[model samples]
Target: MERPRRWLEDKLWSSFGPEQASANLRQALSKLRTALGEDADLLQTDRASIGLDEARLRVDLLEEVVPGNERIELLEGLDARDPEFEDWLRQERAQLQAMIARAGPKEIRGILITCRVDETAPGRDRMTCDVLSNQIGENISEQVRAWRQADPDMIGSTDAPQSDVMIQSQLVHEGNGHMLFIKAIHQPTARILYSKLQRIDRLEAIMQSETEIARTVFEAADQIVGKLPHVLAKDRPETRSTALSRLGLYRMFSFDQDALREAYGLMDQAFRHDENGLYLAWSSLIRLTQMMELAEADQAALMEEAVELYYRAMELDSDNGLVQAIVSKVRSTAFGDTAGVMDLARTSLERNPTSAYALKSMSEAYMGSGELQKAFDTSARACSVARSSPFKHYWDTGHCFISIACNRNDEAIIAAEAATRAAPLSRPAHRSLLALYAATGELQKAQSVAEKMAKIEPGFSLDAMVNDPAYPVRTLRNKGLLEPVRGLL
Candidate 1:
């Protein structure tokens, strides 16, 4: 059955069942074809025989190829009633197991589709796509080149002539942003080695969408680089990309202006050098946060830029759960569109129910809509989910708000303190804590927190913040449930 040189159709079918030879073989092939989708041709078939498509399907039963160190477990939990068939399967498994023991994870060749794939995609420009292809291809090629030079055992290259492996990728508009998909394929046999999907969320009122593209390219490079070992002992451009990628998540934990400026600077260099939607998204968030310190006149202009940045990010990949939550919260502000806020919150939760950010944002939306019980339940779940996340501050803050609404002052204080501790450096976390203390008539504690906040931000005054246009959100909360303690602040 294994030998393909002779007409072994009957022998191959004999291994599976003891029935009409031709019928069973045909049935099995048909089922396999259905499962293979576009790669059904890998199971080559002729009128007189059957064989593997060696040209497109390379099966390394020996130590030859490994795709991203991925283990392909075969015939798992499979059972056969026939003694002969079961014995044959066992023999095959034993042989494969021996090969596996000798084989190591060393990537050879891969492909990168550096071309304009979505010509018909709405809002997509051919020239822009071509430029993007060059930027992305070059950066990825450099990273892999650096890695390969460090690791002598790896045999493949993305830029090598007649490379054994290749990567195909494309960008398409999705929701408010865009999504990028990449598939690695073996060249000799045209078999998909591996694939990945990523969301690029940032595109509100973007002037230079190309920057977003460059950022995502570097972001994708970081993903690939992570799977492979440091081909080089030293860091390269890919290392910088890694640092930038984590900035977005890190922002939720720490809100240091100097750190944000450094991250934004790195993002700008990378965009000028390579761009991604997420970079723009993070930049917009940082800009919005900076608005608190800007003069009132400059606030409007900066916010407009921030909105544009967000729009651009969204056009690239709106499905980003954290971005969705951020957008939802932004739209919930006094100057924001309530309908837009609700829509984003609902969609964010739909995409990721366990997302601490999404759940926290949705809970706030529920609270704003007077759904007190629902808000408390959602906030509770957010806290539970966030216990293991970097942005636990979000759920903690949500809990503080919802608990206060339910007149649960003790729980509110505890949750507020938790938020403060989770991200002590975060301005929002500190603000939430201060608000809870002041609203509950904990004048002494409020004074202590106010002093701490003063060190974080000079001239800390609740009245001044609420009156600031950039702090419309603070005003909204103050006017609503926090009305009881207005004079205390």
Candidate 2:
């Protein structure tokens, strides 16, 4: 019997192949059937019955060859094979058990449909049912009724053969029924579906219109400016100038002096006694003086106008720090005076000590005026104060720069490293690292830092560094920084 069983097994093995044949056995079986012609059914039955091994081999083969409805049918009838089928059944059961074990607990409990129709049609016969608490169910019914009334044809006609449809009805713990029905008509053609999706809607159309209008306005403004020089120098320059003069003194900044003076003369003739006109005239004069590089006269005039603007801005909002800060910086730079700028900055700091801009200005002013210790102290304080801000790295880098300047090499290295970690992309952080590397005689480290800096700022040059008025060239030269890397620079 074992000899006959072994002969049968060899025949089965020849038909079913090896254990790994389960992988694509279905495709092989289909080809075998097609090749065997009239004997295909007998071969299939023989392949199906060479014990559980053959049964399992058949199950795997069926899974691949028949899909959807036929696959479900084969699975349903799978248990009706011989008694030896238990082993193959055990294998499948174990596989399913493993899959379930891997799935763990679902976040939500519900039925999951693994297969569905690809398309549905409008208007055949359909039924929808929902199980829910009475009140919620009634509410849903009312909404459905409303939907039906609003688009009765669409709702009624969504049952066609080959229509696109997805119907999901879920019941929840709160006694609510959620029913999702998606249905569409069979597309006339693939091209029609593509065209429908690609078409722009009303909102996009409106945006395109607004963009075109903005472009037209900018072009018109450019054309006006291009025609100004010709119009202001022609035979009827006075009339044209008079019309342009009405645009106010701010307009003078937009024109050349000759064109500006002509416009101004027209304005003076038109409204000589008006205070606003006088203010405009004075403002234009001050601007022209600045443009001509009459710095002494422009400084006096600008100071007066700035004071007036500051007062006016204050009247609008007395606590406006931006206006105050601007007035302070202008006064400081114009007259070489630090009193106003320092006072204003200190006041702002008292209110919001973490204001990075004010802290930066105080540091720069102190540094520029030969007060390295004061600059270092101010920057350290700023770093401490700005610890909570997202821009803390900026203050950290500032403090590191000051530390390097004050010859605190260890402290500077630590600060520079922290700055790089905090803001890896910051130019100042990399520069500070380079400076620290050069100071510590780490020539290779300094070269690496320089390479990183050059990658970020491709236009950076040693010539630019030497000519930079802000940096101390003497100290840079003395340190031999950027000297060895001259060829790369």
Candidate 3:
């Protein structure tokens, strides 16, 4: 009795008894051998000489007859005599040569030819014939001459013969051929090299070219805006209003309040009669309001243009979460009204449960309201959503600042250290580190950090620090911060 076939017995014939399974296994093995192109004599002899159990064990022995890598060598040996293989090889070689030719003429100052010959043969006699037959030496000289003629700026002589030609050859006893190596060097005068450098000096010529292309586009846009005022003061009030509303939106970035006012007046004129024009006017008003935070206003105008833009944007696209979120942030920050902002934030969170921006906004609102724990929770959620977000620095730095504010110096130091590691280039991160060092009575460390900040922004000064908006000097002083560095300042 013989052992059973593992795959056939376990999977296909597992339900059958041993004898029946063995019979099925034999039939399956026969089909596989025929499909694999095994000779009938070898298959029958092996099958007949062994019992079912023994034959199953012999399968592993038969598998080693053809190794994977040797199969390719065997295929190549057989292909050498096949006409189909010869035609295919010729076609592939021609395609490769064509591709090389398409790359165009390349400069060749040296040539290397390698050949293997019978070691038992006379070395000098074998090399003499091989050198004469090989066209490699001639091809290299031609390439060098062509290259010199094509580019006169190239550092080489066109008419002179190669100054040096070196050859190295190797012989293998078992192989039928010898290995030959050749190198050729072209010589040129030193003056040619200097000329090449002079040709490259023209790269700086671009600085003389005028940037009129960019200036022309700006001038055309300005002309269009200038014509809008006349068009808006027309009989067709609706058309005029639409033009004015568009102009108002365009003037938002211009920082020209007079132009903005003129555009606004035209928009207002259109809004009185055109509902569609009202939305545009309102949207422009919101953008303008957002830009006014740095203006001379003592307090941010909450009931003014920002709210109007939000309402207009909502009217145009009620489902736009981005517009709703911005509007909510402006209302909360400008008016110091967190209740409405919190509710809007929650709504935004419901829409995009995993949004980092929404989470960060919620955290900011909490921080604004002096709700430290809530801010931390919201910030943690934002970090979970986007660990590598630049906003993470904002949250981490804010957390550190809050810790400092509460006189938790150790906790503040830990958070500040993490923020600095996360974004070393961030000014806020360095500022936090400076504050942490100063609070911990590390004046030298604070000064070192301040020096780094000064290197990044040369205008960073103690006088500028006194009026700095991001982290004010008064706040630093009140927190018992920068006290040690006061002498350095």
Error of 3 at 15 (Å): 91
Off by over 4 Å in 1: 1-239, 251-253, 266-274, 292-297, 405-407, 461-489
Off by over 4 Å in 3: 1-326, 405-407, 466-487
Provide the lDDT at 329 for model 3: 62
For candidate 3, write residues 1-489 as lDDT tens digits. 333255335445556787886787788777867875734433332433333334433331132111112112222333443344465556755654454333222332322222222344575644542432122222222111111121222335466443322222222223443332222222321111100001112212212211221122122222322333232223333333434454554443232335445545544544543444234434554444434423224323434665665667567544433344555666664567778778767665555443454566677667667887787776655554444433355446656766666667786777777766766655555766787787678889888888887865445775455445533344466776765555557
TM-score of 1: 0.47
Query: Which structure among the candidates has the greatest TM-score?
Result: 1
Error of 1 at 263 (Å): 4.2
Give TM-scores for every candidate, taking all chains together and pairing residue i with residue i. 0.47, 0.32, 0.35
Candidate 3 lDDT for residue 214: 15
Evaluate residue 329 in candidate 2 and report its C-alpha lDDT on the 0 to 100 scale: 44
Q: For model 1, state the Cα shift of residue 25 in Å.
A: 86
lDDT for each residue of candidate 1 in 103-214, tens digit (9 for 90 to 100): 3323322233323234554554333444444444444443333211211123344554443334455667789776766564444566654466767664321224333443
Question: Clashes per prediction?
Answer: 41, 13, 11
